[model samples]
Target: MKALDIRVMWFQRALHLWLLVWLLSALPAAEWLWEHPVSPELGDPGIVSGLLHGFGVWMPSGAAVPVAIALLLFAVIGAFKSRPWWIGALTWLFFCALTDRAWLANNGGTWLMRNALFWSIFLRVDPSKEHGPLSLVPIQVLRLQLLLAYAITGLQKLHGTTWTDGTALGIIASDPTYGPSLLPVTPGLCWAVLLFQLTFPLAVWWGPTRIVWLAAGVVFHLGTAFWLGIVDMAFAFLVFYLLWFPEEGVAWMMRSLRITSTANTT
Candidate 1:
């Protein structure tokens, strides 16, 4: 029962930040549609658009920009407010936008962001109140979901000759579309990433290694983003790291900040 009194501020802030980044990163796509107009390849939103259209909601050809802007504002306000319902509503709307056939521009990371937002709706937003871990079920579910993603990806990689031989990164680095011109992807680095992903869940469960594993995760994801030119996807992955961030750590950080501020005021 003692462990149930978890504080949610860290998760809230992380969700807010992720939403902001996701919205901001989406701006360029929105801008492109605003300038080019909707077409099958450029702006075919997705399944959500089809469903909505069936219901008589005709999403205009060039509405992506305004929709993204509104979601961006929602995220900005969420950073300072405790309106979980508003966040949830806006997130659902954004998901609908993402599903538009003309807006077929998403990846695994984007899906992760959407699921995280869906779960965050159930998190308590008031920092002053203590909530049960049971009430924080969404956070736990997200952690499991992320771990499963890592495990499944690692297991899948194991079946690949390139990953086993450590030539997988080299292969990716050679890809013309997503490859980095400057950064070199070596066998050692590829193996390190594979091992890290395979062991991440266990490391987090071990307590002492959780912070180290998370730090390493940040480095790995950032490196991937740099090499793949998928910065937004990296941001989405990093946002979930907050789930493992401990309540004690956040409380201590808040106390230290408060003490520093008070000393400066004196």
Candidate 2:
């Protein structure tokens, strides 16, 4: 297999593993989020629900947990299966159904995961054939999605007073729901974040600056996970970061893993 194909294959497996972890973590709250109580109308049912409804296949309240479980199982299969094409499709559909049913419980991370799963449907995971030109299309779409997300968010932040005045991070630090009250926030830190987001789309495409920006992204997401209490969101973005990894980076990782495995056996 070519380097790009290898990278794509690894990325798919890693993404599936991350999705499995996420689903496992959410299992405890399945009853609350999917089974009963709470505001379900807070989120729109979206196109998936509409399509299901059109087909006269409305998801019953009792079906939500089962669907969620199925998705988790499919994710596990996808992680290990070499040819997970149809499995990936089913996973995405089940995910969309669950998310649509319990939209109120979801956040940006959930939507990002949904989008990633959608693209995963098109990813060529077959190990035998060399993925031709079409395989790169879905990968490019994933890359564009991340770039667009950051670029648009940064632009929107520029229009907002809080981000422009460097009060955004300070405010986030004080928020009880998402942030730790005792966490220190600085204006310079706020602007630095803004700068990174705005420049990431452009910088990440350049070879020299790609590694630098990706390294910064690691710090950024890790800080969000630890300080802001947004572990899912942080992991979601970090998972997508795998797509930006150079081919050499993937080769190096394989070598390191082989060495570690050898050492473990000895």
Candidate 3:
């Protein structure tokens, strides 16, 4: 492939990588899905149950539900195979429950892993191909939800004069709700975060800029984990996006993981 062609491929994969980072959030989302069952009593419950029913899944709370792992495995395999595309899409819906949990409980749900898990499938779905009717419906729904999230947050982020002024990081760090640990270095950290949120989408482009920006992205997520105390919302949560960097990066990760797995087998 020509250099430009290779760049385009990696860029496309980087997009998927971003979504995959969001997909690993399945475990915590499954927990919330069990504890909080949505029904007609909650008002307009048809949407939730209807979607689940459409899939082969029934969501009643269970302590030992392997649903999360099942879905994760299913998505990984589907990324390899081509099962009902909607299956991957439905996985995102299940995690939406946890995002709701975060909003309802007022801590972005204390489990940002849902974002990783949902995006895992999000980045993988090939919309141009057919996956049958049920698959398409849920896929569309998932896309809408993702768009809404970004649009809403982007607007809210802009609404704050501090964010617009390029100091949103300070706000997040100083705010007890998000990143109190950075309160000491709020000014510098705030500038870094503001720039990150603003520039993240652009990192999808190619060249040295992408790598330097992506490495910065990892550091940025790590800072969030340290300063905000959000559970598992760190560089590790987002490493999947780096799969687009180079085959070597992905290979290194897989090889290391294999080594660790082999060691554990002893």
Candidate 4:
């Protein structure tokens, strides 16, 4: 048997858990399937109808919740061990279709989730096995996706007055809807956020700077969660950070653990 890349295995496990959390969080929304089906007028009437209208064997609303829950359960199991890669991917694809059928609730985050889930399956399905070279492709794609998100968000801030004026964080914080209002939102903090986002992609690729930024990223997301009350989104982004963590660091960690175990056994 080939020696598995322990680093990739752990990364895959993180993704599995990330998917589980998002899927479980969506469970409450299943009621939507019964309450409102997709509109026939949106998208193509035939395609939309085709999604909902089906033989007794299958239909969007009829199967959406059940499939989602199954996928969620599978993710939970996959988090602990290997799962059938094709089935897991197909389930996520179907889930995306169901969400599209309920297009009103779809947002950029949902699209990102769909993309992430699709790419995640291409990683190691069997946690026990070492990852093959092909698995790296999906991980790289995931890394690119997250970096693009950060870069785009930061670049967009350049277009807006509040972000540039140093009033953006303060404005959002002051609002009852989104904030840790009592916490200070200084201009310096705002500038730091801007610069961090703009350069994160580049900075993270280098060995020495990667860990510092990765740690900072965790703190950044925690702050965002506090300010925006978007705990799920923040957590999701943080999970993606695992993709950028250095393989050498992981290998060193594993080696340390092995050494400690050997010492204990002596």
Best by lDDT: 2
Query: Candidate order by lDDT, highest to lowest?
Result: 2, 4, 1, 3
Q: After superposition, how far is residue 124 of candidate 4 from its true place, in Å?
A: 3.0
For candidate 2, the 10 contiguous residues with the lowest summed lDDT are 257-266
**Candidate 4 RMSD to the correct structure:** 5.3
* lDDT score, candidate 3, position 244: 35
lDDT of 2 by residue, 1-266 (tens): 44555556777887788889988987898877667735444334466566432212465657777777887888787778654578887787778766665677778888898899889889884445655678778988987888888898899999889888879988887778876665568888889999999999999877779999999999999998898778888888888888888656766676776522111100
**Which candidate, 3 or 4, has the higher lDDT?**
4
lDDT of 1 by residue, 143-210 (tens): 78879888989999998888879898887888898865566668888899889999987888865798
Ranking by TM-score: 2, 4, 1, 3
Model 3 spans > 4 angstroms off? 1-33, 36-42, 47-49, 52-155, 164-171, 178-188, 232-240, 246-266
In terms of TM-score, the best-performing candidate is 2
Clash counts for the predictions, in order: 11, 0, 18, 1
Q: TM-score: which is higher, 3 or 4?
A: 4
Off by over 4 Å in 2: 41-48, 52-60, 126-130, 257-266
Q: Summarize candidate 3's per-residue lDDT along 1-266 as a digit string, tens digits.
A: 22222222233343333334444653456444444433212234476545533223355435224544554555465444444536656655654443343344324422333444444453333433434565344334433343343345556777778765656665565676774443465555555655565565555355466677668766766666776765344543353343335444444554665622111100
